[model samples]
Every structure is written in structure tokens, then in C-alpha cells.
Target: MKKNKNLLEVPNINSSDAQLKKIIYKVEDNIFNRFFNSFSKSEYLCVCSGGTTSSCARDNFITLDLRKEYDHIHLEKEKNLIKIGGGVIMKDLMNFLGSQNKIFPTGLSKLPGAGYLLTGGISPLSRRYGLAIDNIETIKGYLGNGTFISLEKNNLSSDQKLLWEGFKGAAPFLAIITEIGLKTFQAHPIQIIEGFINDNELSKIINLAEGFPENLSLQWIYAQDIYIYILAEIRNDLDKEITKKYLNKLENFSSLKIKTYENYNQINFFPKELDLFELNKNNHSEVISLLGEDLKERIQIFIKCMKEIIRSKPNNSCYVASQQLGGKTKEIDPKSSFFIHRKSTWKPWIYASWKKDDLKEKEIVLNWMNESWEKLKIFFPKIHLAQIHNHLNSHEEEVYLSFEERLSELKTLKNICDPESILPPL
Candidate 1:
């Protein structure tokens, strides 16, 4: 068995070194077989893709780091498809797509590749183009039993089709995705409006946003004070007037201080030179709430609960944030994937971070987060696995809540593909 050590130094899979290529091919062929046939379970392999937002990457399992091995990004403009390596980071992917005048629905610019798709990626553009899973045409990866698998919707058998559906939302449990082929859209300049608003004014903004057009997306981060951010993209020159009409709706919130930026880079939505995963490296916990259209009525109550939690928080680093989710996201066919919370209008999440080795602070923040979740969950019952999975204390029950009735079907598919349970527990 390979000893547990940092796999960061491993070279890319495309390296010219003949010796390394031979070693990687040999490892790939026998790794899964060994796990299935071996009596000793002393060591297990866990795949890593830069460890950007996954707690699994930091665990004690022997790491199979893909960041150095499979970071390729290829664009096929004529076909409107892009094939991205699992190890590619969102920043690099977005920049490459931008240069080619194309775009894919990746929720955040800082997120890693595979985890984003495996967890049912909810993007800023999801309101228009649908979730990232909806854009996937094919996924090439290795099943837990060391068998290589290539999946595409049109070419799958009945059983493979079932596995494909599960792969769309719960892929981390079934396979280690190596590359993904996704549909792309024409790139357009974005108009950004950002500002602050009080909790009382949050309701009015939510009402206005509920009726927003497909071109606009609303996102907000509520810290000690609530800060609002909006991104409106014009797919064509003709859509500018419609975009302006939507922006005008926000004027109703008098307390909202807003500023507009034309032709902004979507990446600028996050802080430059900051690694969000690194910021929460020590002790961090996040609870998600998938709020439906009823959110219009419960918006104030939700904000109030978050305020109370913030007031009692151990530190100022923790906050409440949400992303708009309805538009095209709800229009996807129910049988297409395991992402079942299609009717949800907003995905609100609570994030808390503390210093390393500060067990007291960690306990306090986790308790506060869990308490707040209990109160807020009644308003938004569903959870998005992409934001919270097994690595972050999420169990099979909680993870299955995101899939609802489809959980059993997904589990059967998991049993067939990963009988030895080589992947993380879901």
C-alpha cells in the first residue's frame, strides 16, 4: 500500500516522461482491483482536485492528487463544447473561455472543476442556462472498481443511463471524474450592481428579484451589515433594454446603495488573490437552505434568524449569503439528473470560520451554525450537496435530502459501481 503523503508534487498526466506514464497507467489498472480483493483495509485512496472546497482532500486517506496530473482545458468552438480536466480551477477555466468568447455555468470562479459538477453546480448564470449538470454532454472517469467508464446521455444503456443520472448530482460517490464535456454559450459583457441593504429592506428586493428576467442574477452576502451584489448579462445587443428594465426594479429598495459596472469580468465577483478555501482552512462550517417560491413570504424571518446568529457568533468572520436559483434551473426535466430541488428560488447558506487549534471557538461556531440551521430549515427544507457534502459532516441522510425520492435509486446505482466503497461515504 502507498504511504499517506502529500501528492501535490506529482507531475501532470500529459508529461513527456515515459517512466511516469508507465507508472500512472499501472497504478490506474490495479488500484481498484487491489481494494476489492484485499483483506486489509488499512489504507484507502481518495482523489484530490486542488482541495479547493473539499474537506475530503485534507483527510487521512491516501491522496491521489489530480491537480498536477490532469489540468487540461480544450475548447471546440465549432461544436460549442468544451472538455475540461477535473483538476482545472474555475479561474483558469473562465479566463480560457472568456478569451474564446464563450462561457459555461460555473457557480463561482474559485471553485475546483470535478467537485463543482459532482455536487450539482449552481451557477450565477444558472437562472438562464440552468445548473452546470444540465450543460454536461459527457463525463469520462474511473469507477471505484478500477473500471474505466465513459458516459453520454444518447449512448447509454438502461443501467448505464441510471448511473449517468446519479453521476450528474452525486458523482463523488460513484467515480473519480477525469474530464467533462459541457455545452457552452456565447460570451457577453456583464453589468454589475453592488451595494448594502438593511434586513428590513431584504424582503422587497427578494420580491423584485423573484420576477427578474433570465439575463439577471442576484447574489448577496450578509455580514455584520448586509451587502447586495447583482450581475446582469446581455446575451445579445438587443437584450440591453430588457436588462435595464430589470435593473430598474431594484430602485424600489430606497435603502439599497447601488453602483453599476459595465463589461465586468465575472471573476471579479470574488476577491482577487484570495483563496476562499484557504481562508477557511482551519475551522469552517457552512449550512445550506434551499428556499422555494414561498421565500417571498419568509424572507424577513430568515434574515432575522441570521441576524440573531451573527449577534451571538464568536467572531466577525462568519456571515449569511444567498444565490438566486429559479429561472431556467426549474425548467429541467425531473428525470435528467439527481438534482431534485429545481423549484427553489434561493439557496441561502451560513458560513463560519475560525483559527486552527482553537477547539473552543470551533465548537461555539459549529453550535451556532447548527442552531441557526434548525430554525431556518423550516423555511428552506432542502439542501444543495455541492455546498455541503459528506466531507463536511453531511451524512447519507442529509445528502439524500437533496435528492428526495430519488435517493434509493441513486444508492442502488452506487452499489453497482462502487461495491467495495472505495470513494468517500455519501
Candidate 2:
């Protein structure tokens, strides 16, 4: 296959574990081992299927492409578990699971790799099944030091347990995940309710979300024109009656545009392609806000701040979006993984884009996003790691916030497994 010029190319690894180890030894001896003495000589990146939303998969690094080596998806019907390679995309996995009448909470976007799970994947089905990271059973990966490790949650040593915890929501910094085993659930029919709602109905939307059943998920996107595009997913017919009963309340405020799907394929979840602009590598600005107890009040502030940012946007493509995160996602034990934003009911984020060659426009958008974030952050202090890439803001601080109380432990794991800092810095 012809490689994309925008991406880094590496030799394909199509061999057994023994041969793979020899390749790793050779590569380490020739390149990675040298990083210990000269950290600035060359940067290294682990690109798994190239689905990263960030520019971390650029040509500047010595990229280790895992797509060719690990792109298999195996379903074990007896065990009710599915083993997915790091290279597998959301669409491929969803299709395979849907074929077997099974499902796993994963992101709606089709491009993101299993790396999405490492950042606390919030899916349309998450309200019932919990975050993707919560379903993980085993992780097999190579550390920055070229050591291959396989860990199971059911059986772990003290040190292994710590590393596992760090890997759950912060895997990029810890290792290159080759494959993972996750628990699966039975697939169910879905009902999609979508429409444009005026700003006045924002509070009613929040009220509906507060009482949402576990089988329902809500997503609201604030467009550049100030209209709120609301999309909701109802899991199955079992909850269809109650779901419609609550949705009926939305009709009082929103103009309805409802649709239904028997399975995942019928629903359109892919993002629209922007032809004129691209994500600004140096100036891309984004911030995730975790809504507190005052949902309605905080959402009002969020909408106002987003409107201000949108009005002053350097480009017409920039907008704000949010995902509901309160049902089964909130029930997961905070201590189980590094992702600790479970108490949050909503995750609102700001995104800024610019013309490919317009440096001035990039700067303006970045400044506006940052300034707007500062004004709105008072209402929601916590952050989600998935949407907040390293280049967007204070990289280290964002990593610190994602890990929060477990920062020290994660750092210690980094020291032990990646002593040379061969991998990209968080």
C-alpha cells in the first residue's frame, strides 16, 4: 500500500513474537538506545492505525507503525470477549460486533483507533454499558524500553497493577498498545431523535438529560449560527416507551426531526469534511469542561461563552460541542483507572480551526479559544483527556489534570518503564 506523504513510513512487521523481539532489539540498538544519551537528537512516535485526532503522528518523529503488525479482531463467543488490535477503527469493530449481535461502548467517529479507549471513550451506548476503558479486560503492549508486556486485570502484581491503572486512560505516555481484550454486550436496536433547538431551550435539554435513563445518550452541538443541533440515541425498544415519554417533553421546546435505526449501521455518526481549513498544528486550541452539580446554570454559562467565542472566531468552521456522561459512566469506581472525571454529567469542549496557510488567523483563533476557555472554566474545572491534545494547551498540565491524584504514581511508572524517555512527552 502507498503510504500517505503526511505520515511517517516504517518497515512492516509480519512475524511471530520471537522474530518481532529480534526486530525490536535491532531497532533499539540502532536508534532508540541512543536516545538515552541524546534525547534531542530525534523524537519517537508510536502511530497505531493513524487515527489520532492530534498531530502526534507527524513525519518529524521516528514512527513505529503498528497497523500492519496488529490489525486483527477476534471474537470469542464462549467467553463473551473480543480481542481487538490497536489498529482497528471504530467502524470496523462496530460492524464486526453488530454482525455477531454484540456491542462494546466505543466512540461514534469511524477514524479513531483503539487509542480512543485509552482516553475514556464516551459512546452513544455508554449511558448503558459505561466508558470503553471500563470494559477493558487485558492489555498487551510494548513499553518505551522495548519490553513487551501483557497484563490482565484479574491477576496483577503490585507494580503491574499500577502500570495497568496508568494505562487505562493514559496509555500513550506509558506504552504502545498492540492489542486489548474487552467485555462485550448484546447489540440492541436504536432510536435517534434529532432537531434544531433555539438557545431558550438549552435549560429544558439539560433537565431532560438529568433524568435520562441508562439506555439513552444525548449529544448537543452549538453551531456557528447559534442554533443547537441536538442528537439523542435510545438503545432498544424495551426503553422506547419511557424514552419517548421524556422526548415528548423536548417537543414542547424543540422542533422535532426524529429517526430510528435497527442497528449501528443506519445511524450517521461521521463528521463532515472541511475542504478549506485544516486542524492547526501549532495553534489548535481545545479545552474540556466537566459540568458540576448546577447543570442548567453551568450550561447557560457554557452556551454564552461559546457564543462569544463563535462570534469572534477567526474562521467560520469553529464551533462548540458536548456529550452527556452521567448514566452507567458515573457508576464506575474512580480508583479503577486513571480517568477520574466520572462525577461529571456533561463534557463541553471548544474547538478552533484555521486556514492551512494563514498564520495570523491561527493566532487569532488560538487566542480567542484560550481567552474564552479562561472565562468559562470557572463553571467547570475538570478536563477530559480524549479531546484535549498535547499541542493545544499546557501539555504537561493537561496530562496532570487527567491523572489528577494519581499523577505521582503514573510518573513513577514512567520512570521505571520509560527511563530514557524514548516516547513522546505528555
Candidate 3:
């Protein structure tokens, strides 16, 4: 086995390189085939993306780092499709699309890779275009059993169709996706209003946001303070007037800052403070994302719970945030994807962080995250498996919540695709 120490550097600190023994940097056809067939069945194998969000690696695990090998971007203008390697990051993809005057549904942070799409990507414009998975036209990858498969949305046999559905929301647990083809959209003007809000304004904002148009969406983060962002796609004069009326309602907030961009990629919703916190080399963090219904009646109680949780946070890095997801997202066919929470209006995620290798701090932060999730479960019951946590005690619980009814079908498909359990446990 080829052991390249430099290949071990992933974004998340939870899976330290010190714990890994084998990392294959070569992903070419013949080399990868040889490595895959020869690797021991007992060994834990994970395909690491360029923008890894968590430490999916563990002690003695083997990783296929696609960062260098799979970094190509091929755009088919005639077909309005963008094909990218698994290692391609959101920022790079957006830049390329912007240069061509095209757009895609990318999340606020531009660091994530294909894992974002495989997890059912949620973008500010998702209210209009639907989840990222809904736009994926093609997928090519290798199942855990060393089988290569190329699947397309319009062209698939019955078995290939079933596998395609499995890959949509449960890909990390089934295959190593090497290339993905996503349907692109025409670039349009984007309007953004971002600012801080008091505890009282949060409820009002959410209430008003319920009636937001398909092109408009709300996102807010609660750490030491509450920050809110309203994004709208300005397609015409009507859109501008609608967005203006919504902004006028929030004029009571003195800190609101409004800006217009040519495309969604130009807008960055994350606060600078949080960005700086993420830049801290000593920080190690984990996030659990949960889905919920509209908090119309439980707004106050939800705020109170968040306040209590924040008060007990281990550090400044731990916080709870949510994004709206009820417009076009809910209009998709229920049987199409693994994201089954069609009635979900919000996706709230708890972020916990501490200094790297501080075992005491890690334990405390993890406890805080777990407790926060439990408390929020009263309002937000479903889980969004954005990142698989094989190391956590709640891994099974998260899996149960994420796949729900389709889980049995998924299990059957898993048996056929990954009978040896080479991928993360389902």
C-alpha cells in the first residue's frame, strides 16, 4: 500500500491523521482497482473529499484521498450541465459557473465538496429550485464491493434506478462517487439583507418569513447574539417590490445591511466572527442538523430553549442556527429522494467546538451538543444526515431519523452494493 503522509490532511480535526495508517493518493483506474481488491475486508475504508466537513477517518482506517486525482470541471453548455469531480469545492464550481454566466444551488459557505450534494444540498435559492439532489442528472462511482456504476436520471434500468435513488441522499454509506453531472440554471440578480436582531425580533421575522415568496428565504444564527439574513432572487420589478415590502417590515432593526449581487455566489451569509472562529487552527468542531415544522405556536418556547442551551455552552464556538426550506423543496415527489421530511419548514443545526485534543473540553462540548439536540427535538424531530458520524453514540439514532420509512429498502440495497460493509455502517 502506498503511504503518503501529506494525503492525510482533511478539513475536520476529529479524525486525526495520527490515527490513520493507510492513505492511497492515486485514484487512477488500474491503481485504484488494484488497491481496492487487495485491501483487507476488516479495514475501514472511506473516500475523503477535498472539502471534508468531518473526520470520517479513524484509527487504522484506509482513505482514498480524491483531492488531487478528481479535480476536473467539465461544462456542457449545449446541455446546460456541469460535470465535476468529487474533489471539486463549492467556491471553485461557483466561480466557474459565474464565468460562464450560469448558476447552481450552492450553500452559504463555499468550502464543501460533493458530499454536500450527496447529503441533499440546501441553498438560499432552494426555496425556488429545490434541493441540490433534485438537480443532479448523472452520477458515476464505485460501490463498496468494487463495482463501477454510471447512472443517469433519464436512462436507468430498474436496479440502476433503485441504486440511483439510494445514492441521492445516502451516498456516503454506499459508494465512492467520482463524478457528478448537475443541471445548471441561468444566472440572475440576487438581493441580500443581513443583520443582527434581538431575541424578540426573531419570532416576528420567522412569522413574516412564513409568507415569503418562493424566490425569498430566511436564515439566522444564534450564538452570543442573533444574526438574520434574507435573500431574494430579483427576477423583475414585482420581485423587487415584494422584497422591499418584506425589508420594510424589519426596518425596526437598526443593524440591517442590504446589498445587491449579480449572482448568489457573491453573497456570503456567514458572519465574519464565525469565519474567524473556523480559521482557528486549534478548534475542533462537530455539528448535528435537525429538521422541523414551522414554529408558529412554539416560537417563544423554542427561543427559551435556545437561550438555556446557549447559557450552558462550553465555549463561544457552540451555537444553534436554522434555515428556511418550505417552498419548492416541499413540492418535490416524495419517492424521488431520501430526504423524506417534505413538511419540514426549517433545518436547525447545532454546532459544537473546542480546542483540538483537549479531551475534557471535547467531552463537555459533545455533551452540550447532545443535550441541545435533545432539547430541540421537541420542536425539530427529524435529522438531516449532512455528515455521517460513525464515531458518535447517536450514529444509529441519526440514521434511523434520516432515512425513516425508506430505510428498509435502503438496507436491502446496501446488502447488494456493500455486503462487506466497506463503507460507513448504515
lDDT of 2 by residue, 335-383 (tens): 8888887787777767666654567877887787677667656765776
**413 in model 3: Cα distance from truth in Å?**
0.8
lDDT of 1 at 179: 88
Task: Kindly report which residue stretches of model 2 are placed more than 4 angstroms away from their true locations once superposed.
Answer: 1-42, 226-238, 270-294, 387-389
For candidate 2, give the lDDT: 0.66
How far in Å is the alpha carbon of 227 misplaced in model 1? 1.2
Better of 1 and 2 by lDDT: 1
Local error of candidate 1 at residue 394 (angstroms)? 4.5
Order the candidates by lDDT, highest first.
3, 1, 2
Q: List the residue pairs that clash in candidate 2.
A: none
- Across 349-408, the per-residue lDDT of candidate 1 in tens digits comes to 777666645778877877777776777777777877765445445455477668879888
Worst 10 residues of 1 by lDDT: 13-22
TM-scores vs. true structure, each candidate: 0.87, 0.86, 0.94
The candidate that achieves the highest TM-score relative to the unseen native structure: 3
